[model samples]
Target: MKQFLILISFLFVYYSTAGIEQAPPNFKVRDKQAVFVDFRRAQYNITFDVQNHRALVETKILFEQKQKGYPLFDLVNRPLSVTIHDKEVEVSLIKTPGDASKLRMIEKELPKGIHQVIIHSEIENGTRFSTNDRKPDWGNVSSGFFIRDLRDRMFLEKYLPTNYEYDQYRMEIDVKVTGTKRWHSLFTNGEKTKVSENHYRVRYPDFYTASSLYFHLVPINRFVRYYLTYPSIDGRDIPVTIYSNYRFYNYLAKKKAWKVMRELEADYGAYPHDQLIIYGTGLRGGMEHAGATETSIVSLGHELFHFYFAKGVHPANGNSGWLDEALASWRDKGYQTVDLPFYDSANLAAHNLYTRKTDKRSYEYGRSFMGYLDKQLKEIGKPGLKDFLRVFFAKRKLTTVTTEDFKSDLEEYAQMSFQADFFQYIYGGHMPPESGHKHVDHDHGGEENPHHPARTEAEMLSIL
Candidate 1:
């Protein structure tokens, strides 16, 4: 009996301690900091079973180990199974500290090299899209059925097992979806290739891995689709399409879009993508995506302009949201000649750029800061926003830009220092001095130094 107990202890020590020693030296993790891996790409095959209120999904991810250590994948919800390097492995789904979403990481140690991982899971089609009667409408305000609606909705959480919001994994993807017989139409960001009657494939060369995969699955009766070609400045035909419910609204929206596209082309060279698709939503305003945008007539111009600033040259990460927002709001000519209200001591530079909570400040302060850029450009006797955009887009299109990168570009273009302006107005969160007001003199290139007028709250309300 004593010999049996001694044998069990000896085996435990061998398997726990000596077994780990047999791993590669890089895998001998002393602490969490030693783990370093770069996620490369992810591929997804999904079967959307709306009738069953669930989806069966399989995802494969490719990653490279920068050093000898384990890599962690930000996976939300429970997964049926997780595998590393083609082998099923045990994984812990501990709640990540300081996160409210109950997100967990699938962590595994690996040797220093490239590897492929897979996750298979079944997800519930939650009641987020259900009506009071318990019928799923998918936000079909137009009386349509859409599987992946982007009406301020999050399909990523339900369908994808991914990392946290800030860790953006930019990668190419090949996606296939089946079981769409009930839906009338489906629209995705990639080029559509039909495989079977109800099965389809979409291919993306470089998808914004960190962002949500937006899909619009709508009933046929809800949308009016059309195609038209506009002449580019370089004499090439640009194919444009619009999907919406109202014919009159689509007509007017197309007109505005064409004008904006032309203006953007002239300023920023050619549009980067092969074609542009605009999806109309019952929801007010719009959101931008690569090669496409979702919008309404009220915000057609603003959202369309994002193709150049936001989608064309994406902001580097969450902390750089102001870069694109500032440019987009600046391009929004609707705000140029109005009663430009002042921010209530709110500055965009000092604000955390990641969360959606800062959107209001990002727009208000970002627009004001961009206005400051116009002032600086004019001070050097240079043409203002248009010329600056021409240069910026030429240099940074189809890429990501950081705040520091934008500042450097502005400094280079103006041929004057912007160190103080960046620090005070952007980094320090200080409102621009009164000198940046529209009332400042420009005809004689001289400053009036006049006291700026402050309207009463009632006047502000009336103007708004």
Candidate 2:
């Protein structure tokens, strides 16, 4: 009997500690289970089995405001009563409903440093409503209501743990609904354990995080099936998906689309998430989510490039999200085509063309610049390029940057004014600078176009 007990105990220990090697790591503690959030009563009510930090808030918001089904994410004229750790605090609230939805509460006095906050506000139930297309016109484009409300967590600054910077935070979400379906598909971080027709729960480490907006996949549309792309750059079983309206594209040429992203991995490192995605959306552009990025299928390379640049590379040039879009577009070329000078000098010509189309969308320009930088990095030596990117992001902490910042940093590093013309070209959208132009090889430009055409995924294994 004693021997049997010992054997059982050993088995438990082995299994508990055994599976971690193949799984993603967890950095922060997350709350347990699929708990319900009930806001269908008088004032927004919140209750959770407190295992960690806790906050209780009472908000004075107009319950009769026009709700396009995304109220907490929509505009509000109501005041708030913030209660953190049982202490009532006053906070000023502001909301801007746009692509970059802004909701911030300015409070001058606090203990001054970091403090976990909780917010309780009356928000629209976000239930499905048949609109012009089940998507409201929030801006020039229209989208399913919840898509616009992605950053809604930041709407309540008085009692919620939200800010511009990324960090880990625990949340217990409870939204009351009157629908027949009690289960909703929740796409979150971590492994999928619980799955139902209505409820979906997943967990994640989330070292760096921003407020996210997501409902079940069905809220927008129905699922086709989870498809797979290359499992990894080395072709490991890195499964990526394309949630489409119809069947997943299976053309031999279509699978070739992932090659661009594979090259991107060589520089920034393999995809942070194995599941690179491009979901069908009504909007023309895409948004860079942490794991599964969403955009149109035809724009797959450009969209995936955003994940590599925005999520992988640190922001160097400050022009809102410009660094993200331009870098992605630039990276797409190498991934899409094996053409010459197109990988090198020809890329610069495209970049000059990109900048000429004033108001050509910010993200695309950022993609181009990122591509330019990658080619330049290869020319300057990998280690030097690594150092260049390091210096660029390190100097600009918590702020957007511009090529001017790089020019200044480079001038200091090279001990001369480097790429001054390039800086102006980036800012003024002028012709590519002679020195910074991707085609410029004034002195030592004779490196022989060094990209191989028949390099299979097997050969690419060396990069990872």
lDDT of each: 0.52, 0.34
- TM-score of each model, paired residue for residue: 0.71, 0.51
RMSD of 2: 16.5
User: Residue-wise lDDT of candidate 1 within 1-464, one digit each (tens)?
Assistant: 64354345334322211111111112222354234244445667766554444556788766555565556554445778888756787555443222212333446667776566788876443311212235443322111112121111132554466542333343333333333333345566666776653456765544243343445544446577878887877777867778777777679878888888887787678877666777775455556666676666777777667777766675544335556666677666443522223433333443322121123345556677777667666667998856887888888766655566787788888887777766665555442222222211111111111111122323222211
Model 1 gets an lDDT of 0.52
Tens digit of per-residue lDDT, candidate 2, span 324-381:
4444545444432211222222212213211111123333433444544445555545
C-alpha positional error of residue 67 in candidate 2 after TM-score superposition, expressed in Å: 37
lDDT of 2 at 356: 13
